[model samples]
Target: MPLYKEIILKDNAKLYLWKITEDIEYLKHAVKLNTNSQNRVDSMKSESHQKGFLAARMLLQHIGYTDFDLYYDTFGKPHLTDGKHISISHSHTFSAIAISNQSIGLDIEQVKEKILKIASRFMDVSHLENLSETEKRIKATVIWGIKESIFKIKNIEGISFRNHIFEEDFSLEDKKATATLKYENKEENFDILFDSAEDYIFVCAFEKQ
Candidate 1:
């Protein structure tokens, strides 16, 4: 499970996913990491986290990038040295990245019943109307991913998922959506694309042009 999938969302934007099926030792030797990345990996307490980090590097390499070409800002947002927009996300067993000429955000989350318990916190419960229990979970997870993606793009403080981001009504059949980010007298719109695979939902948010 090296590169799970590569999606050309637009002419200038692409997405990559890496399935973390290799052991840490295998990954350690499979990819090359910069000193900073090596130290960061060494500081990780959980093997899962280390593997996720390594898998992200592997995905970057698949796109002709290495850890040396990536860095994080003060807000912990990742950027490429070549002035490309990059965003990264990792859940339990998968890591993903999106690179674009313009700003973009990417997020992946496992579909779990637990999101239903916190549905009220992040999304409009009414949006979940007329759907089965399974649909509810999927919708909730997508909405959560939507907000997370937007947050990554903005990476601003005081941005509460429940309070700042808003998603419009959408259906699973559409496989697409839109969201608004309203914070601190600033308003922005995003084009959203999403799909589910193997019980995981990944969402991509691109700044409206």
Candidate 2:
């Protein structure tokens, strides 16, 4: 059980992260999945993806829930049968989920130079200035993670990371920030919490109440 980190947020909401160190075979046999999930996993084309999917089920079991308790709506957003809001994300070697009493979103991203290549695609480049190359990449990855979390919360079509979401100015030391989602003639705010582990950044977004 590589349950890497468990965070207890406000209002009984919780965040769970799993470091995927096991083989696909180990994860496949460790958790029970419904027919839909089984078929879904069987259809995965990549070993990395298959491992991430299985690791998610293991995370569910870590928190005493199973695949039977989870389902997706027509919009493709996952929901827990017990009515808890859930958002999930998987990076190269890490998977994360956030369960909350209110709308929530989570994302894990590997910090690498590739994000810097497309920084302007989803974030403001000025935000990267005055920082070392490594910090720039890490910060850019955090911004991408921020936007992804917000997108998971909204789940609305046509919300472009560049055109719709805006993350407030914050230094790395802050460890927290705020963002706004402007879409469909509506504007909503979200609170963001982020951290780095093993070169990966994990972020969680909670809709402003």
Candidate 3:
């Protein structure tokens, strides 16, 4: 699959998704990676991980950028050389990236029943009340992505999903929500956008200005 979807969340922010249908060999030859990225891919033990890594770069090329224009900071957050904010995520068969003029975070996760088992560990389980088993799983997955995306935006140390990140109550049909981060005596808010693709949930977070 080429580009699974392209979403213009805002005038300055966009999201790109790639469904990983091609083999590693096809992805390897589809995009040219820098030496560092090539070495990183070579060091990956899981073919799924390698394909996800490569698919991300493939998306960059589809958007007129490449691996060479991307770099990471000491905290392992990705940034573009041209000063655009970038976040990357991959789960199972899907890879995605969000680029924006403002700080942003992106995350994709496969919906699974296991999330319900540990939902209390990272989110407010009360939010799960009155839902069918399937809805609970999807909502839990989205809340998890909400916290993950916010963490990516902050990239700070000692932020616990259970304690520090909080998602406001929202229904599945809303497809968007807000979250708060209370860590180290600092309180910050973020705008959240999320949707499902197949069995996967992808979320985007933007630091509220």
Candidate 4:
């Protein structure tokens, strides 16, 4: 229930993951939130969402930072007071945050069959071929995470997952891949690293230098 995992990425980015097993009350008591975060959590209609938000703060504290040191820009992208890049994501019962000296993005998604049903909308369907139903579900979820992570890094408007983001062909065994964001007449490359935690898939994206 504490920090579930810590990953030191190849790019030197540090990622922290937390499994949300604590009740909302316990999480509320564990971390101090700024007034804005408190109001944001109070406005959440779902207890699960609130727990996820708190779990993220719990991770911040685990790494020697607190809510007061974190803030969101006009686009809602999170940044640290010390100028480190930060990205936060929570899904189902998992919460995760990634920190890097360079720009970065992080996303986590629960593996579900539903992702396969809509895979074509955001990814190249051909990449889904030659895989079992279960693999398809996991791969689709990863691709979705890929696009979501990249979008977080760019934090720009008018980017479409189905149109601007693209993932190259990759097999599950690879455990990593690459993607490109072609938006506004410019193409940016990103290095992607992904893995499964419990039933969730988490992806991290770092812009290529």
Count clashing residue pairs per candidate.
Answer: 0, 0, 0, 0
lDDT of 2 by residue, 52-130 (tens): 8889889999999999999999999999999999998998889888899899999999998889999999998999989
Clashing pairs for model 4 are none
* Candidate 4 structure quality by residue, lDDT tens digits, 1-209: 87999999865689899998999899999999999999999999999999999999999999999999999999899999999999999998999999999999999999998897798899999998999999999999999999999999998989999999989999889889999999999999999999999899999999999
In terms of TM-score, how similar is model 4 to the real structure?
0.98
Which tens-of-lDDT digit does each residue in 71-109 have in candidate 3? Answer: 989898899999999999999999999999999999999
The lDDT values for all models are 0.93, 0.91, 0.95, 0.94
Q: Which residue window of length 10 is worst by lDDT in model 4? A: 6-15
Task: Compute the lDDT for candidate 2.
Answer: 0.91
TM-score per candidate = 0.98, 0.97, 0.98, 0.98
Stretches off by above 4 angstroms in model 4 are none
Query: Which residue pairs in candidate 2 collide?
Result: none
lDDT of model 3, residue 71: 90
Error of 1 at 98 (Å): 0.7
By TM-score, is 1 or 2 better?
1
Which candidate should be chosen as best, given lDDT against the real structure? 3
Sorted by lDDT (best first), the order is: 3, 4, 1, 2
Write out the backbone clash pairs for model 1: none
For candidate 1, what's the RMSD?
A: 0.9
